[model samples]
Target: MKYFKYTQYLYLVASILFLISVIVKIINQEEYGLQAIIAVGFAIMFFVRRRFVKKMENNKKNL
Candidate 1:
């Protein structure tokens, strides 16, 4: 549980940084490639976390 909380915190920080970068790039009229990559990366992270949490819940029910 502690580890999960830590991971969640890390993801939150990463998401904030990604958003900040995207905003900065937009303001500077830079390319959108980096922003797209960051968005995809965070999407994948969220999907993975959701799957893991679901699996954990299933395991708890089985126990």
Candidate 2:
């Protein structure tokens, strides 16, 4: 159901958000737990999206 072409844009947003989160955490130096959780969550999503995109591309090639 997911359109693979949009994954690149999704990653772009996620990466920017992740960078912002890291910067905020570094600047504030507080609540390390929440910041770490968010960072990890985004990282996992990025990998999942990457895999889904790759699968979609392979399927497209076959068809």
Worst 10 residues of 1 by lDDT: 2-11
For residues 1-63, could you state the per-residue lDDT of candidate 1 as single tens digits?
647634754665686788788888889999867766876687678668867877887888999
Report residue 55 deviation for candidate 2 (angstroms).
0.2
Query: Each candidate's lDDT (Cα)?
Result: 0.73, 0.72
Off by over 4 Å in 2: 1-3, 6-9, 12-29
Estimate candidate 1's RMSD in Å: 2.3
Model 2 lDDT tens row, 5-48: 67656765776687687788788885556656666677777788
**Alpha carbon deviation, residue 59, candidate 1 (Å):** 0.7
Find the candidate with the highest TM-score and give its number. 1
Q: Name the 10 consecutive residues with the lowest summed lDDT in model 2.
A: 30-39
Q: Measured by TM-score, how close is model 1 to the native structure?
A: 0.66
